[model samples]
Target chain A: MKRFIFLLCLFLPALSWAQLTIQIQKGADKPLSVAIVPLAWNGPSLPEDIASIVGSDLKRSGQFAPLPSGNMLSMPHEASEVVYRDWRALNVDWLVVGKIVPMQNGYTVQYELFDVINQRQVMLDREVGYNDSLRDVAHAISDKVYEKITGIRGIFSLKLLYVSALRDAQGQNTYRLMLSDADGAREQILRTQREPLMTPNWAPDGETIVYVSFETRRPAIYMENLRTRARQQLTNFPGINSSPTFSPDGRKLALVLSKDGNTEIYVMDVATRELTRLTNQIGIDTEPAWTTDGRSILFTSDRGGKPQIYKVSATGGNADRLTFDGTYNARPRAMPDGSGFVYVHRESGDFHIVLQDTKRGVTRPLTQASLDESPSVAPNSAMLIYATLYGGRGILAAVSVDAGSRYLMPSRFGDVREPAWSPFVDRR
Target chain B: MTYKNLGLSLGVVLAMALAGCSSNKAADSANQNGANSGLGSNSSSTFDPSANGNGSNLAQNGRIVYFGYDQATLSSDGQSVLDSNISALKSGSQHIRLEGHADERGTREYNLALGERRANAVLQYLVANGVSKARIETISYGKERPADVGHDESAWSKNRRVEIVLN
Candidate 1:
């Protein structure tokens, strides 16, 4: 009887390991190590692969590092086939294995997460969706897995808006405003013009965009509904009209207009078109960006003898200078957290993007590129996308705030500029 | 009413004759004394010389040249004035700085390049006219620096200028 009991104890652990239970811990000293095995599919080759897309999406977050197949100890297709001891030997805290089985009209995906330390199966998610929705499904799974581990919402479904310019013979320049996935996928042209388009900004709701256009032989601001494709001319003043920014609440727009005899900031109601002047200074007051709270706005002005950032109340009050370090500091875009602002700073005859900490009142250089301009921060404030000249051609590049990861998005048509990251879309 | 009208017309006629006589005398003095004597004095005491052409008021100081919209080509009138000023600087052997500016019509980055091109055009003109390129340096302020506060064509025309300053 004693010999049989010892044998039973040894077999019990092996049985538990095969079940592959995952435990979602509250916090860990470091980010949990996860290994995502390639999905096993028993069907005709699908138009899209979900496993590769999920891996790429998770890796782009910078918080999670997905292990490659070679580093993985065991490739498990089902929950019963997992070897917890192999994964624990590799120091992997979590292991994910999934399979795709073809259904009548679509495909059914079943995935399982295991906790190698506990030697048990923790969670399982199964869904039936179309093949064309594979990327979306992958993003959804990434969000779920990330939130389950990191305790913060993932911005996987957001979008980005940018403007591209192509100059042809006969001196005709074609400008296109494009909308694409946050990862630069599935791009669709929003508007096209033979003239120049500048300063594409997103509304708070993420469904509309405001920008400046020079189609009528003069610069004017316009707002377009992305879904309905309807455009309204926001400003048609006699003089210079540019730099349109939406307020946080989406009820108003703050912009620069020289029709009042000087380039001053103005707040106009989006519905009624009633105007209220904000600044009365005899300086070049342009590039107006609203604070996250919507109580004040930060803009670039030369009132202090050089172009620097100044903040004023949205309802018109005493303006306060915000930047004093560089000889040329302009294009202030407030971060989502309201803790800092990112703008182009010129030092030693080279322009770079720098982050200004509002609390410490100090600026830190973020990029060392020579001519990086027009930086827009992601909705999560983790990365910033901006335009730079690469090999004498304009291209868009993104870099993490810590300068750890960088990527480039070159346009297939022509040069791209003025990238605007949209806020997180409301997922209902 | 009759008295007020008579006084206004009389004031206008008297002002016109006085301005014409003073300009004639100023011209005669300029011919005899040369352009250097007129440098330190206010030229407004004589008739305004920029009334006919779109001459920038900046030229009254004899230290600036203006360009048309989106153009770097020097107008004939602007060239003649800059020629005389360049000759004076060459003869005086003075180091000069040329500050270029642009109107707020294009994007800021493009405007900066445009302003630099305009200033370089002026620099080339000066160098071809026997002025040493080493004696003149150029800095483009782009649209950051504007002399006129308005956004109209009148203001934009005045804002696009290259100011020559002696170092």
Candidate 2:
């Protein structure tokens, strides 16, 4: 369990640290080979695949390589129907089998995970939900199986927010802010405008998200409540009002504003609307992300004459440059554990995602794209997704924290960008 | 209004002389100034400079300015374009919006700031040339509103332009 210090305890009298407590699961490094058989459908219509979601979820974590359905010798829906010798001959370490039965309320999904080497059942779980939320139900089961095996919570239930620029039939480009599942299902449009939207950051509770929208004819940060769909303009500074991120405690926001004549980092208490200036730099100091601890902010700056990750106290002090390996390193997204950070690094004519361990002073590139950007880390710290151009179109791709596993979140339509991974949402 | 006087005072020397003097010398000066005056008509007219055989390019109709890669400061061509837009902007009651833009090469946040810097650079030039601050509003589309969708430098160069949107 991770404990938050309640960074704003002094200012917020009624604040409880319990509400802010969030665990940042360190991802398992050793890859595990697992097999997930296609779930037997008891209903006429199979809205979703519980096995595929669980397989994809586990595969996305960089922890497991799920055997493709075609490669399996037999399809078994339950432990009694399993052929242990066949799976053992296939060299699989773990096996998962499930079946979905349609009920009056929704569907009942029964899944069982087995240790193929031990020839014994490890977990048997059942999940029930409304018919409309079949995708959610699949993710819920994935979460249970993942945590049971990896000892880390699954983030498949968490959603992602991103901006996609698609040209309509009129040949006019329209920008849309979208709310979508991690598995690329049930895409809901939050807002659509001709003007560009950028830099979306999620509030800790996953109830509100703040993003920069140009609908007002200028870049301004707006905080929107997900439940009510109500939005309030947060900042409309004269020069540039963009790049807003919620502090870990959810009490304050760490953002970039140029209202003072130069782009600099600033913080505002969400409740009081009180603004506190952080970095004062002559050069561009933008893209502010709060450290998981909430005591410091990591941001991208060119104070060193080129863009690199820089760190400064959440309250305002001397900014310390954190990167030196590359000529360009910007958009510093600190991991949930604060163990290290992930950033867009430009090296050898390509912009790729890289993870930098602050304590160890080690840097590792996590992607191989020509223009990978807008990396949003999973709540579990197990994986991250970033926007990259594939086949001349913008697409979002995910990679494990260790750069061990990778997959592309299939681009639905148009050019997508600025993926903001939602925090681990509260269970419904 | 004050704008007409300012326009007359700025580069519309012929308009000033035509306003100040008798209509007699105005024809002679118009001939001397050639079609550059009518061809250089600002926001107040339906004249297209391309209509004449001048072949001086679209810069002749000037309200837009272009910049080099990764640069916010205007080039010689950009400065000349702004120089021509001043008189028309002065003569009109319309609010001038300098919509700054950049190529799709950098991060959105940084590009936004860069775009604003480019717009501010143009704003300063207009203010330096006597366009009122109240009559001008600036917005940065950054790389979002690309004039060209191609990925090459040709497309990028076209996208790295600040549109002089006069309303």
Candidate 3:
């Protein structure tokens, strides 16, 4: 009987190991861990650090948590120098390292990603070009790493358009509509005005932007093609034409207009310029944002006596209020999954970012910082970028939806406001 | 009285006028109290200028009008004053510039629209009262200038008004 029991115990262990193998084969497990070592630089101090930015782009996706450089046994600048044993000892599933070398036209950034456990180099890359191309190269590397690990595309190559404000001596307000890399590098100003310009939203294809500007001393919506620098004013209504947002398919624009006695939401056909009023109410209805499916819109209205989030069908219907916990909740940006939305919620008179689950009707406070506003979600729905006041200066900040990752993009110029996260850019 | 004392008193008067020139609070309060005094009402006499600190008095006495948040409609009180002001303007020969203003409630661009609405509301009333529209021109300062320094409700009520300036 004792001999039989001992054999059964040994056999039971083997049976459990077989079950674990089955589970692994069925893809029931966590993702592979990745470690990105700081890249080596051979050129003069770069205009902007590229490796750190790439690492941050990967980290914000929530799929990877970069290990600190101090934990690295040896920093490898080339694929030939990779010591897999060193990374294996640290239990790192993958390793990424590279070096930037000077080139005639610009710079060459050579990088490699290694599967430490497999003892093989997964990605060997060569990005050759100018200083302006470094950011794109970094994004490409990030894309490669992301695809190798998660089997999904990375949106790091996309660009974000935002509004930058400066007050001149003549008491004139100067607004510069700017476009920059997703990592906040390679900033290029698209338009400058002596009046207020706001709500810079990108087109679905990432080639154009639609925003509201007071260039003619009246609130009008304007669309500008980023490549050609051509612009067209969409609305020159007699009263309040503002808060323009593009539909998901880019065929129409959702905007606010008060020409018919009260401010209300309106949808304009991009091709025909025909207008259709969506909301007809006495209260102010503005700040329209389309749902991911483009079937409905979420906007702010004071019909409930205070500013709150309300949802109406894109085809027009009775509006439904979505927020109830706060006295003031505006700027509702829906997540990509249609699962929830993030918006500015007033708590104790200070505005902060809050996430609301649409299905469950549950709200979660994602930020505790004071005065965080204009929260926009990444195309992946993993992170949020918003404009907040830090040290009495306006700066752009990003925070994970789970409240784990946080970072700031402080502009060296004047105040930065109204940061619009671009949709996922398709890489050819 | 000696010339020196008279000159000193005159200097004091000039300083006061300069300081109060831009602020209508002092002048408005004085007028209200002077009206009460003419009725022989010393009972509430010590007349604290700050009692009607809210620009509501400006709207009630036909010197100004108030609008809703992001609105420029003439409230019943605002319409009553405009009704009387139309007759007064028709009798007088002075041309007026209707200066429009808005409270610090909405965005600057929206505020400009609100201010213009307030001015137009009054202009429309005057035109209906047989006053020539050409006699009045309108200008909107939006929320750039405030009649009261406070940021509370009373101050906002006072700031959202249209002042008819005789030119």
Candidate 4:
């Protein structure tokens, strides 16, 4: 049982604090103003601050601007003692107040949301969690509040998967596959190796993951179950074997292989290990990602002399180019609804993450960072996390899909890259 | 006399680094020398110009071949470097591995493919020049491993290269 946590901390050595510090770089031009008053404690002071955590979560989303607690005219823990005029005086459109009550083995956090503009109560909810799980409860509260206001699901409770490489004194590198909360807490390293690992992505089931590892001295695709810790190498081809992405249905894995002489896209049946080559081109055809319906695949190819996103039938067919605006576009991951995708777009020599809406035929860059790449959209499609260089070290940065909110999650040590946001897990 | 010994030690170290046999020390030397000796540099000679007369020195000169941005074709300078080491390559029966690499600019998976393309290009050149196809193997590290850690073009140009490692 003790060995369970060591795997989580193997690559992050000698660091007392391993959590990534979240720095909000930008927010929406006109963010909604909300006040989250500090929750009143009924018993001895708890370890976690529920209201503060919830407020930070909301603020990081870039849609809601959490008002400073110092500016709250009146602190109302319950709806019965509410005062709308006080919140209105501060120009706050929404109000949130909560209180903590210790239970037998855990605590219950009761919170209320009010519409300052209409002078009405929007919601009254309570969450119960143990001491160590208090942060999760806070995220759960934030999810509820955000969904109530935006009519879209919140990703506060989701997980993030990324790879961090730490170079030793000898300049040799050790790569670690890390799993953490969306806000960069509870970091658990699933795999660590001296060789390189890339293109880690979650299965739709949220219990398994696929990534390319050079552990065997060559590129190979590997699948690991997060619960049992069981590992299996899925592809061991002679040439390049990489870019393994699980299909939406979790049945087939779309990947790239150069076994037949050149880089090409292929799909492998997860159960039987059957292979289906999808793209046949002399040029490089790689980075296969499944569309929302799992009926077609989107991949990056240099068939047109420059890397561009192309779409092809999942079974097999001619691929049609999807991106026309950029001379260099690659690594396309479609949105949840198949309405749009996010990819690496090179404009004026700088690589930035851009979102393309297929339904509306509109494309926009979501980040201003010069070297941004590996954009992984959240389960809800509200935000995305990508790898970028900050202060000459690789760090994970996030941006809202609408380009409204921007934040940087810099690790305490080494370089973090290729962040894959997990799907919404059914906690029940 | 001490300078001769130092040169001998550096030659062994450079050989191991070029052969992909040594670890951190080799990578460190690659970083230190790649920028100076890389094809992107205006000066092509890595060591003393007078040392070019020796076979071992010619082999060392041909140990690395750099490429332009998003390019897999061998430049004239690259071809000349390989031509100098052809005698040493043909004389040895040892197998070789061409480790391809790319700078950290594009998507990693694409870079992996690009690196492979570059290695294949090198392999073709060697095979066409009389090296047996079976004697050479190729692997692309993509942008995962870099000859230099710097982010500037100077480092990137050095990183975007194929290393000829003799086993």
Q: Which residue pairs overlap in candidate 4's backbone?
A: A8-A189
Candidate 2 stretches with Cα past 4 Å from truth are A1-31, A40-43, A60-63, A68-83, A99-104, A168-171, A410-412, A426-428, B1-61
Best-to-worst DockQ order: 4, 2, 3, 1
Q: Is the docking of candidate 3 incorrect, acceptable, medium or high quality?
A: incorrect
Off by over 4 Å in 3: A1-49, A56-72, A77-80, A88-93, A99-110, A115-128, A147-153, A168-170, B1-21, B25-167
Q: State the C-alpha lDDT per candidate.
A: 0.68, 0.75, 0.69, 0.83
TM-score ranking, best first: 4, 2, 3, 1
The residue-by-residue lDDT of candidate 2 on B74-155, one tens digit each, is 8987888778657767766766677788877777777777788799899999899897889887878777766556666866
What lDDT tens digits, residue by residue, belong to model 4 across residues A1-428? 56866554454533435658899999999999989999888677777888888899999999989988887878889998888889888999988888888789998889999988999999999999998899999999999999998899989988889999876433446788888889998787777787889989999889899998988778899999987868899999988999999988899999999999999999999999999999999999998888889999999999999999999999999999988886899988989867799999999999998999888989988888778999898878888999999999899999988887899999998899999999886665
RMSD of 4: 6.2
TM-score of the second chain for every model: 0.63, 0.64, 0.64, 0.69
Q: Looking at model 2, what is the TM-score of chain A?
A: 0.87
- How well does candidate 1 score on lDDT at residue A124? 91
Ranked by lDDT, the better of candidates 1 and 3 is 3
Arranged by lDDT, best first: 4, 2, 3, 1
Tell me the lDDT of model 3 at B92.
Answer: 56
Candidate 1 has what TM-score?
0.67
Query: Backbone clash tally for model 1?
Result: 8
- Taking the tens digit of each residue's C-alpha lDDT, what string does model 3 give over B1-167? 12222212221222123233323443444334333333222222121122222222122244566676556778887787677556666765656557578865443334544666688788888888897877776655565444542345765776788866543
